[model samples]
Target: MNKSTINLPENTIFEVLVTTTNNQKPHTKPFGMKIQDKQVVLTLFPNKTLNNIKNNKEFLIQFTLNPLIYTKASLNKLTSKDYQNNNILKEATVILRLKVNKIIEQKNNDKYGENIITTIFSTVTDIKQENIQVPAINRATTKIIELLVDYTRYNYMNSNQKTSYINKIIESENIIRKTGNKNHNKSLNLIKKELNIED
Candidate 1:
């Protein structure tokens, strides 16, 4: 796979939906990853996707900016039909099939507690393009992506932090109005309802 073919910048983490399988059932989740050379670096905790990859040894990476995909994945609502042939997400534009190359164990400790973090280095084994779609580098999508990351921590944050994140979400919603598409609106609303953000 040629890394330069993709529009991603040299060192930026982008929010993307990835697919893995547990017992051959396809699962999708949003992740922040960076493409460096021929490998994609992903830092993961002991989640379903990571655990699945540990046993399965590979996963599919979807390259698209549709927030609805993230919404479905975040809500755990992906059905069997969302996948193609039990391996690839049907909505994907450019896809990368990666095989695990390296796994590093990191000992993490904080005010909450200690935990182990896994850093995965996966080499691209196959690159497929169902369609040629540009990777969006706009503020609307960027802010929404940032909000998605923040919402993942909502249940663990204090009330003040939660308020700050909600404000960002509102601001991002406005930006999406000007710069994003209908799918963005639909996905943002789904997430807002899931987060229980009061109008």
Candidate 2:
């Protein structure tokens, strides 16, 4: 997919299935996440997952690529799928089980809105690696980056600001390369080739 097309589905919410200590079951919530350094950074809105992490400091991250789930999540109408009895793989590519180490809450107010951004830092405890050959790229992340790029056209930004955003995308792609993600590698190479930056 091209940059615009690939980034089209971003900013829309996606299901983040997590296993928390408070519940003996796996809970699924819609979350907006960013891919940074091979780690999925989740920003919680002080909800169940946030509370659970605050209490026990550990959780699992399962990526659900279902379009229906994404649509529901975007509309803030997602219902938790009960995985208490039978653990079934509905729409997860790779499930990353993690233990929280730190939490950072930042107060910020922008022209668009005002809110507290909660950042959760966690370590991967176990990874249920999927055998699917396709590379797992967070579509939301790429779209968000593209949106930021588009937003820049209206706002006055210095050269550094423009470079910084592009660099973030490149860095994310680099992380995929370091992780040996085959699909990501192919996509990254394609992007490089398009930009004529391939060495």
**Candidate lDDT values, in order:** 0.78, 0.51
User: Model 1, which residues run further than 4 Å from truth?
Assistant: 1-11, 110-113
Clashing pairs in 1: none
TM-score of each: 0.86, 0.48
lDDT tens digits, residue span 27-80, model 2 = 454455654444456776556767877887767666554434333333233344
lDDT of 1: 0.78
What's every prediction's RMSD, in angstroms?
Answer: 2.8, 13.5
lDDT of 2 at 32: 54
Clashes of each: 0, 0
Put down candidate 1 lDDT per residue, 67-87, tens digits, no spaces: 777777887877878777746
What's the true lDDT of residue 93 in model 1? 81
